[model samples]
Each structure stands twice: as structure tokens, then as C-alpha cells.
Target: MAIDPTSPPTSPPRDTPRLSTRDKLILFVLCAANFMVALDFSVLNVALPVLGADLGMSQSALQWAVTAFALPSGGFLLLFGRIGDLYGRRKLFLTGLVLFAAASLLATFAWDPASFLTGRALQGLGAAVIVPSGMSLLTTTFAEGPARDRALGISGTLMSLGFTIGVVAGGVLTDALGWRSTMGLLALFALIVLPLAPGLLPESRTPDRPHLDVPGAITVTGGLLSLIYALTTAADHGFGRADVVVTLIAGIALLTAFAVVESRTDAPLVSLSMLRRRTVAWGNLGGLITFSMMSTVVFVLTLYLQEILHLSAWETGLVFGVQGIMAVIAGSLTPRVVSRLGARRTLVAGLTGQGAFMIALLFLNEHSWSVWLAAVAVSLASMPHVAAIISYGLTVTSGVPDEEQGLATGLVTSTQQVGITIGIPLLGVLATTSDDLLSGTRLVMGIDAAILLVGAALIALGLRTWRSAGSGAVEAEPVGSR
Candidate 1:
């Protein structure tokens, strides 16, 4: 007889505590690891031009540098999360850090584009494990209330700060030491995190879960890789190619099979029933849209800055510096905003603001050098989004027990990555199909606005569901939850 994977194994009763010295240390190590992960996400953007020159690659090949990391990380989240639950999160976290560091070293030494991409793909695999385990550790360490709130707040703030600073750091490194050194720095950081993990973090266990779902894991992972490759190929060669069509069909078929398998498995990787939870499903849907809008806009803007404005890599990075500063500020202020506005309202407002900013981009041009407009809009747009993301993360995590937090966080992260991966190609289609860059940008921006508005509407529906659920429940509500 098999056990139900949807039901997490029980541990001793949870003990939530104030920020102990150990808690702070755990936070420090995890944050360092997360910064390195987030750093890799945008760090390569600054180096793409230099890399293209060095490797004799085309625009399409350059995009793969980023996509290779994203697709695997997103696709394998459920698999890694389930593994974490079955084994131990601490073990997985340490393992992931080591793998990530090794991959970084490989990336630093690569002389060819293919070798470099292979390293990045490995880095993504490591991140798929690290991210969920880290989140689960944090969720388990801090119990509900002020302790959990502050821990999550600090974590969220540092992550946003990492995104802001990584670009600058990556640019400076690219200019001074070359693109390879950017990866080397990450390797060094990962090494520093290794020794600290042993004493700082506590191990978590789920002894009752079944063995890892190998069949489901392979199916989902293979499906996502195929789908992403097809989309990327479409961006470069158009969708008319037979290879693209075949890959796309195969990917869809495998994913459909994976879903069917999950329905019958005693210990499925991702419990489809969780999606039935209003908080989980709606939160993920909003995350997908918000991330898509953010990523699509940035994808188009990077090209505009480089091709149209002819800004140096460092200067282009500097242009985004203001938005980074704003993100830090917004991240720090998120808890307060969530407390005042409620999670649902905050999310809806954030989605609306982000949509408006993207729509406004339809008017930007080669004549528009007004950096302040972009900076201000980004800063303002970031505030609500940060607040909403952090709040919703807490809300969803709170709905589940500690052991499953890894799976929960992984699901959310995966959805966000999916948004990012799809954003470029989806918008690239609209942007590049036109004869002129400006026309393409406008068309893509309009699509982004529409998508964001749809997300905002979904959030609005979520708000109503949250209120209705709250009215019927007897438990004291979370501070940010209405």
C-alpha cells in the first residue's frame, strides 16, 4: 500500500520563535545564496553583447544564454520540491549550493557558447532545488505572526535588493574582468555559503512520503524543455519549421500524459487538489501575469536601449539603477502596505499600476530620452507588486503546513519563471514581426497591458473569494489578509 503524497508527513509540533542569532545566520546564508541565484538571472543581460562579439553568436543564440537557465529551473520545481519533502530540505539545500557553485566554475572556464549554456542549464537545475528548500526552511523556522512576518519581510527585501544590485555588479564585472568573471564571482559566493549552512540551519523531514515520482518527473521536465525550445526556435526561424511543430506537439502530448499520471499516483509530485485551493490557484495565476508583464517590458526595453539609443552596457545598467533603488524601498515597505491595504486589494492595485506603465510605453520613442519618466514609473509600479507578491507568498504558505512549504514556494517560483520564459518570445513575435522597432514595441506593450488587466481581474475575483472565506472561518486572520 502507498501513502498519500498530498498529505505531508507529520513532524513534532512546530515551535515558532523570535529572531535568534541562529535565525539571523540562517537568513544571512540563505539570502547570500538567493542573491547569487537572482544575480544570474539578469547578470547575463549586461554581458550578452560582449558575449555575442566574443563567441560569434547571433541575437537568437544570445537569448538562449538566459532561457536555458530559466526553462529548467521552472520546469523542475515540482520534482525538486517533492524530493525535498521526501528527503531533507537542509540536505537538498546544501547539495544544490554545491552543484550551483560547480556549474558557475564550469561557466567561468567555458570557451564556447555551447559549453557555457550547458553550465547555465546545470545552474538552473541547482536553483530548482535551492529555491524551494530555502523557502521551506524559512517557513518552518518562523511560526505565524510577527516572527514569520519579519523573517519573510527581510527575505523579500534582500531578494529585491539583489535583483537591483546584480545588474550593476554584473556590468562592472563585464567591463573590468570580462563576462566569464561574472560567473566566477557567483562561484566564489557559493563557496562562502557552504561552511555556514551546517550550523545555521535546522533540518526538516517528511518521513511518510513515498519514493520520488520518476515517471512524472521525466514527463514534465521533458515537456517543458521541448516547449521552450520550440518557442525559442520559433522566435529565430518562424513557426513554419517542421522541427518546431513536431517538438511542440510532442511537448504538449507529454505534459498531458503527466497530468493524467498525477491524477492516479498515490504520491504525485504536485497535488492537483492544491490547485483547488482558491488562495493557491489565484495567487499563482496573478504571479504568472505580473511576472509576464514585468519581463516582457524589460525584454523590449533592453533592445531599445542598446539598438535604438546605442547605450554602453554599463550606461544601460545605470538607467535601470533608479528602478532598482525603488524596488529596494518598495520591498522594505511591503509589510506595512500589505497590513494597511489587505493582500487582495494590494495585489489588484499593483497589477493595475504595472499594466498602466506597460501601456504607457506605447508612446516612447527614439526622441524620448526622458529617463526620469521610466525611472519614476518603474519605482511606483514596483511598490505595489512587491507588496502583493510578499503578501500572497505568506498567505499561501500559511495555508499549508511546514513540510509542504517547499512545494508551495516552488510552485509559485515556477509560475513566475514560466511567465518570464514566455514573455520574451511572445512579445518578440509582436516586436520583431513589424518593420520598425517602435511599431513592434507598441504592439507588444499593448498585448502586455491586456494580459496584465486580465491578471488584475483575476486578482479582483480572488479578493472576493478571500473575503467570503474569511467571513466563514473562525480562526484569527493574518494581518495582511482581509
Candidate 2:
């Protein structure tokens, strides 16, 4: 049965629905698809030097390998999300899967920088469709309760692990096989998931869903593209460059125009009122904070280990591999934790734990032993970090109507991608401003921890209001609703 946001659910919020074998297979297909999307974000990092050397890309131009994927990926998310809702999500999902696979193969076989960059950009465009579509599909498949919670826990775990594992896998694959193998691996994943999806996942067929919002789509997509480009460019070059400055202005202006257009349009691309909901607003902000701060932690620590501690790429990867292991453990246990404590409290506590560990990394230095200490910090922190990641997803999708799950999940997916894309640049800029690399790393970590604490406080306050207003469950009534 479909659900409306304002009305109470037909079933008990915490009731567990039994999953059939078919349901389990559907869950696997959806989560695996999302895992592939997450893997694309970081799997190419260790291969970049090799890729650039082979493709004749300069140091400045090399960043484009990653940036190329990020631009269209982040930019077109909302547009494609709306399209999936209006058209058929299953078709969109298949299209993205095929596009991603083809693009990955293209990048794998490219003989020139132009071709490689084109392939990467197209991969990003495919990712823009996959993430929101996959997420919306998952939510709509299972009702909002215990079964959905379990599925989300698995999805969140895989999503977090995909990022950390990508770094390690990139190094290993680049060493064993050529750099091309990394791109080839994603295409392989698509081959496996594509066949499963077509047979299993249900297509979107909401009768009351609105028509395409052309003006809203144009303004928002333009705004996101400009803004993401500015951020990605600013990471390498400062914000003062002519291109960066112009894009930054264009992004802001276009987004502001988008807001105005959304307000006046009969069929808005994104519902402005949805953004005003206590859970939707604060939940997305929480996701952005967790993803940006935690991901920046990994990056800053990786650089600190390599540059200051003189650890090799292999050693640095080992240090961070512990994070992936701990993330898996934490993700598996999160359903039980959420069952005991609601998503609201779980989010707050998770932030507190994650922030505490983040602050502990401030002591990192050049000593060899600091590597172990850093590893410990990240390992312990991964539990709560994973917790925050899962809980934020649970929180945001809790009260949304079934028809708008695409829009709701789109908002969160945008935050996750934008956070990954923006974190390095925003914090990397701060880390580099100081002449002392170690000091700059610590400065950024400290700032990130502070932001987490402040975010936790604000989110708690927001959820408290939501509870007082009679919606006791901050997320789904199910224990592992993420």
C-alpha cells in the first residue's frame, strides 16, 4: 500500500514484514547497483597517476579524470530524478546501468586524454540517474517499517564500504593489472547487476505524479552544474580565477532563480514545501555534514600519512583499510542500535561519537607510531560514522509520500555526492593555506569536528520539534529503517 506523509501508517510503525526470496533478490540488486555508484567515486584515485601518464594528462589536467565524473554526476541528479518519477524509473535505471558500463569500457580502452575524459563525463551522467533512481526504487519496494530498515542497513553498509574499499582496490588493481582494469571492474559489476534488475525491480507507476517541470529542471540543473564546477575547480585553483568566479556567480544566480521559479510554477521540479519539512531539511543537512567531514578525514589523514609520515601508497592504504572493515561491522549492527534508540537519538549519538574520534586525530604527527593511532581513531570512528550515514537516510525518507520518494531520495543523493565532491576542495583548500602540512591537517580536522558537534546539536533541536508535533518516530517506525 502507498503512504501519505501526513497520515498515520496503516500498519504499526515497528512491525516487521517478512521478506520473500524474491524480495531479498530485489534488495541485493538495488544495493549492489548503489555500491557500484559509490565505487566510481574513489576507485580511480590510485590509478590516476598511471592514467595521466598513459593518456598524457598534466598534473592540473589529471584532476579532471575525477572531476569529469563528478560534474555531470552531481549536476543532473535532480533532473533525472524528476524524469524517473514522471516516466518509468526501471527504464531509467536500466539506461543508466548500460550507459555507465559502456562509458567505463570506453574509459578503459581510450587512447587519448580527450576520449578518456569524455568517457568519464558520461559515466558521471549515468551515475546521476542510478543513485536517485535506485534509492527511490528501494524505498518504494518495501513498505516503511522493519523490513525497509534492514534493507537500508545493508545498503548503507555497502555504500560506506564501497568508498573505503575503492582506495585499497584501486592500488591493488593498478599494481596487479593495468590502470585500465579499474574501469573494467565497474563494467563487470554492471554486467552482473543489470540482468538481475530487469527481472526483479518494480517500475514506478504513480498515477498522481506531476508532469515534467521544464523550467524548474533547467534552472536547478544549470545551477548545480555551475556550482559543482566552481567547487571542483576551486579545489585545485583558488576561487579567484576568472572561470571559477564566473561559474560561482552563475551557480548562485541560477539557484536563486530556481527557487523563484519553483515557488511560482504550477508543477515545481522539487516541492519547496518538502524542503521546509523538519525531517527533510535537517536530515539532509545531517547527511551532508557526515559525508563531508568524515570523507575529508580520510583524505587529510591519507595525505598526512603519505607526505608527513613518509608512508608509501601501500602503507597508507593499509592504514585506511581498517576503516572499511569497521564500517561493515558498524553497518551490520546499526539495525539493532536503531531498534533500541530511535533514528533521532541514534543520529545525535552517532555524531557525538564520530566527532569525538575526529577530534582525537588532531594529535597526528610525523612519527611512525602515529599511523597506528590514526588507524585506531578511524576504526572506532567508522562505527558511528556508518551509523550517521545510515540514520540520515532513514530520517529523511521517513515521512515523505510514496509518489515523491524520487524527489526525497534525490535530495539526499545530491548531498552525498556533493559532499564527496566538495569536501576535499573546501577542506583541502584550508589544509594547504598554511605552510605546515601537519598543522593544516589538524586545523581542518578540528574544524570538521566542531562542525559535527554543531550539526548534531541543531539536528537534535530540529527533531525534538518534530517529535513534539506528534510524529514520534524521527525516521521509519522500523528499527533499521535506513
Deviation (Å) of 5 in candidate 2 = 18
Cα RMSD for candidates in order: 6.5, 4.3
Give the clashing residue pairs of candidate 2, or none.
149-480, 149-481, 152-482
lDDT of 1 at 97: 94
Backbone clash pairs in model 1 (N, Cα, C under 3 Å; residues 3+ apart or in different chains), count: 0
What are the Cα lDDT values of the candidates?
0.73, 0.84
Give the C-alpha lDDT of model 2: 0.84
In candidate 1, what residue range of length 10 has the lowest lDDT sum? Answer: 468-477
Per-residue lDDT of model 2, residues 1-482, tens digit only: 33332344444445344689999999999999889988898899988998888889999999799889999999999888878888878899999999999999999999999999999999999999998888889988877656667788889999999998898889889999989999999999988998888889899945776778888999999999999999889988988899999999999999999999999988898988888777777788889988888888888887888889988877788888988999999988886666556566677888888999988889888788898989999989999988988878888887777788888889989989888877878887887777999999999999988988999998886666344111223432222222
* TM-score, model 2 to reference: 0.94
- Tell how far residue 210 is off in model 2, in angstroms: 2.6
True lDDT of residue 204, candidate 1: 91
